[model samples]
Target: MRAIVLTEPQAVALVNDWPDPEPGPGDVVVAIRAVGLCGSDLSVYDGDRAVPSLPWVMGHEGGGEIVATGPGVVDRHVGQRVVIEPNYCCFDCVACRNGRTSACDRRRIVGMNDPGLLAERVAVPARFTWPVPATVSDGALGCTEPLAVARTAVRRSGVAPGDRCLVVGAGSQGLFTCQTLLAAGAQVSVTEPHEGRLELAEQLGAKRVETAEVEPFPLVFDTAGVPAAWDTSLRAVAGGGTVVMIGMSRSPVSVSTRELVQRQVTIVGSLIYDHPTDFSATAAAVADGSVTPEQVLQAGSHPENAAAAFAKAREAPGKSWIDLSSWREESA
Candidate 1:
């Protein structure tokens, strides 16, 4: 099996003889079809975010077919097309017991804490694999994980029908958040510096698109996660409004306590999606045509082009995916 291994900061190599994953009890080995390159993966590549260990396989969002199932895996079987939910949690944790698995004390993300799907195959718990509809393409199915993150942010924002909401950033997650808000009947506005991304926001149903300026909105989502964007988000929200922070920023930004107190502003930080429910809802949305994957997943790259693919994904307004199926064709 071949895998893309991050050997050091700003370094990646294609290892042709990487050991294949073997399924454990209650797990299955999936033949990865496509994997989505994420911002967090880029962070790891740039050495901005620290991982649990080094020399890790790097990818989390992916879709594939089950190749083999281990004992205790009853429902899922060989040849079932599925999407990966990358979060693994300890069921006995306090947060898990309370149905907040995303906040579990021992939660581990696939690419960060465990071996990821950037290889030809990966071993994952059967419970974390959801069968995707045949109507969805492998490229589209690879985007379900990010869509679930967007869904969680929207839910945390509590943006209802007819509410005015502003989404900061027109990146992949920002665009997904905009679409989700629109599906909930909220009047959505978007702020983005890139003209291509701003155009994408309009195509995704945003009522208004601005490079920097925006009128005060009742609900604001800060998906950019930069200090300047955070400052702008605070000023863009209306008094007594809510600001949902979905993007992760590496540096700390100073906030004025007096302004928050005077205006009765509420700031909430949203992490990744909640376990089964959020992942299931995102897949259902993709299947039902509520969320269009073609709008987000722009193109596919081969494993040999991992470095160039990451660069392209960073500059792209939408998402870019690695086409693992091409490896078989080339190797054959």
Candidate 2:
């Protein structure tokens, strides 16, 4: 089997003889069709974030057909097309017990913690797979993981129809969040300095703002995880309103707790999606034509164009995918 390996920082290579994954009980071997690139992928490639180990197969957002199924996996079988949920949660954890599986104390995100699915075929737990209908578009498939994240944020927001909502940043996450907000019946407004992204936001039926509104919003989503964006989010959300913090930023922001204390503003930190529900919500929206995530993603990049894909992924960033079909065919 062949796989894309990151041997070192800023170095990714295709290895032709990587060993095939052996499915254990409750697992299935997926004939990987595509792998979505993430911002974290760029950070790891640039040596900004640390990986658990080197020579890693780096992809958490991908899906394909099931070629094999392990024992106890009765609900799923061969030839089933599914997307990987990536987050492996410990159901016994405090968070999981409280209905917050996304924050499970012991959760491993594949491609970041475990080996990823950037190969011709990879073994994954059958429970983490979500089946997609043949009607779902490729664009939707390209952003399953991200849409799940967006879905979680919306689920956390407790948003109501006709409520005013603002999403800071028009990146892939921001755009998806914007669309999800709309699908949830919130009047969405997007803030981004990038003209192109703002344009895209308007196309998604969101009002594009030149800046983050200083006025209060019932729910505000901050997808841009920078210190400045944090400050703006705190300032923009009104008293008694909720701020859904969706950015995975490590940088610290110095802000007063006056708004939180005096105004009763709530800040909710969101990681990835909760198991089962989030993916199902997102996939349903895609299936119903309520949202189109692949609008931000480009065409598939073959293994032969891995170099070009990396460069393109870096250029546009976080909107690229490695097409595993070619290699899967070769193996066949």
Candidate 3:
């Protein structure tokens, strides 16, 4: 088996001869097909995000075919194409009891705490796998994880019918946020400096707004973690409207207390999905053409070219996929 091992910050390698993993009780082994590179992968690569340990397998958004199942599993999901849900939580936690499992007292994200999907095969808890519809493209299945995050953000922000929503960014997550809002019947607008991302946002059903045109919208969604993005979002949301923060900022920024008090603006923060259901819903949305993952996926890279993939993602315009099957040619 081959896996991209992140040994340290800004360092990764395609390691060969890694022993193949076998499924445990209540687990499933997936022969990974396609994986999407996300900001979290970059964060992990850059050592910005917190992880329980290192030697990390740095991808979570992926889909694969089930090659085997554990002893206790009886779902008959073997040979099924599925997407891996990366979140695992302690169900007894207060947050999980309240349906806020993303904030669970004990949470282990797949790539961060355990082995992830950026490899030739991944063995994960059977509960974490969701059936990928035959109608959905493989690349689209690879995108459901992020789409779930976007869906969670929309669900948290209380975006409603006829509301004017402002998404302050046009990257992968931001674009999906726009799409989710638009699908919910909100009048969606987006702010992005990148021409390519902006164009994609428009194609995904968002009105593009230049910095000069910033105004108060009914609801503001900030997926860009930069201070300027939130500052602009604060200025763009109407009085008493909510501004939801989805991006992971490295540090805290000062807010305009007077403006927040005067306008009664609500600032909310969203985290990751905690269970398989979120992933399932997102998968269904993609399968139904609601969230077009195909449009957002730019290209793929082989596991051996993981470093090249990172460089490309940093230089290129949009999301990139990790093609784990790239090693098969060598074997052949």
On lDDT, the leading prediction is 1
Across 164-250, the per-residue lDDT of candidate 1 in tens digits comes to 999988899898898888889999998888878888889878966564557888999999899988988998989999999998887
lDDT of 3 by residue, 127-165 (tens): 888886767777776788888998988988887899988
Superposition TM-score, candidate 2 onto the true structure? 0.93
TM-score of each: 0.96, 0.93, 0.94
Against the reference, the lDDT scores of all candidates come to 0.86, 0.81, 0.81
What lDDT tens digits, residue by residue, belong to model 2 across residues 1-332? 88998889878899988888999999999988888887777777777878888888888888888899998899998887787888899899898988789888789878887888888888999999888876765446668888889888888888889999989888778888887888888999878777777877888889976563457788889998888788778878888988899977778888677747898889999888777788777767777777778767767788777756765574462367877867666766
- State the RMSD for candidate 3: 2.0
Which 10 consecutive residues of model 1 have the lowest summed lDDT?
323-332
List candidate 1 segments past 4 Å from native.
Answer: 52-54, 328-332
1 versus 2: better TM-score goes to: 1
Q: How many pairs collide in each candidate, listed in order?
A: 0, 1, 0
Instruction: Report the Cα lDDT for residue 194, model 1.
Output: 83
